[model samples]
Target: MEGLSELALDHVAQYFSALSEPSRLRILNYLREGERNVGELAEACECSQANVSRHLSTLAKHGMVVREGRGTAVYYRIADESIYALCDLVCGNVAKRLEAQASLLGSLAPKKKR
Candidate 1:
């Protein structure tokens, strides 16, 4: 990032933006198991087909997922497998921070008497 141009940084931001949505993250989780069509993803994500489609479109634009046509259905899968590693790294850091905050809050709480 130190030597990246504005355009490259913008693209990087767009990629992260695509992953910022919970729904899109859920969709990616499902795709991790295997390729799935829009309908399948919608059902798994508990979202409407249209909603999932919009997320998929964003994911595709970021090159995070790829689409394939199977007869009349369009299925999506992860384009860059490294995304899992990146997500795992971020999730781990977030979980650690949350745990630390919880510990701090617990210490600050008033003690209960029997």
Candidate 2:
């Protein structure tokens, strides 16, 4: 928290909030393979082109994805690579917790019924 202003913390929170949406997360995950045009993204994401455009707009606004216009189609790709690492760290912790819970359940003995 040292050397960080309140405004800085709020900005960071906003960045996380941008990633909080499932559709936005899906867009990020799809872009991990490389850039894709809006039409391709819409088909891959199984949503309408307008919906995909909205998600891309939010990502572009937050500096999460880069947009390129080639002729009539617009392409999008990852802008901040660290977002994947952040997601991976959270997933790893959840996996560890689930593994521990499974082990605990496996160790429980079944009670005999009379």
Candidate 3:
């Protein structure tokens, strides 16, 4: 982010926005297993093909995933494997925060009777 131009920062925000949706996150997670077509993604994500396609378009626009055509099917894979590292980092931080909150709440709970 440092030394990045305003336009570049805007693009960064757009990329993050593409990742802000749960459906998109699920799609990425599924793709991590390997490339998958819309039907496979829809089935795994438990959504319609059209919905998965829309999310794919958003992810592709952000350059997060790449699509390849094969016969009547199109498959998508992660463009940058580094995304997993980023997701892992954020997930670890979130888990730590959640654990801390749970501990705080537990401390405030009423004592159990012997």
Candidate 4:
């Protein structure tokens, strides 16, 4: 049981590590729209082709995304829609927290000087 738990924890660590990169998050966000080829994804994410490919490779290895080749271009899409749902949940939680903080700050702000 301990071994199994350790394995599960390791898998979770890997998933979180893959998500720790801003570029990777951007790529995931772009993929949320639809499947896109490497070049198009690079353009959308504002990264180089090689950089995007590297990030995609990492995501592919972790089974978070999948690549499909057509003619000369290779396209990528989320491996499972469940990943998108998780991302949405996390982003929504963060947004709510930020909004609450903003409201608190607004309430604390003093009136403008005369």
lDDT (CA) for every model shown?
0.95, 0.88, 0.95, 0.92
lDDT of 2 by residue, 17-78 (tens): 88888888888888889999888889988999999999899889889999988888788989
- Give a tens-digit lDDT track for model 1, residues 1-114: 999999999999988998899999899889999999999999999999999999999999899999999899999999999999999999899999999999999999999999
Which pairs clash in model 2?
Answer: none
TM-score of each model, paired residue for residue: 0.96, 0.81, 0.95, 0.90
| Model 3 vs truth, CA RMSD | 0.9
Worst 10 residues of 1 by lDDT: 11-20
| Candidate 2 lDDT | 0.88
- Model 4's C-alpha root-mean-square deviation from the true structure amounts to 2.2
| TM-score of structure candidate 3 | 0.95
**Candidate 3 lDDT tens digits, 37-92:** 99999999999999999999999999999999999889999999999999889889
Superior candidate under TM-score, 2 versus 3: 3
Model 4, 26-114: lDDT tens per residue? 99999999999999998998899999999999999999999999888898999988987888899899999999999999999997999
Error of 3 at 46 (Å): 0.8
Question: How far off is residue 48 in model 2, in Å?
Answer: 1.6
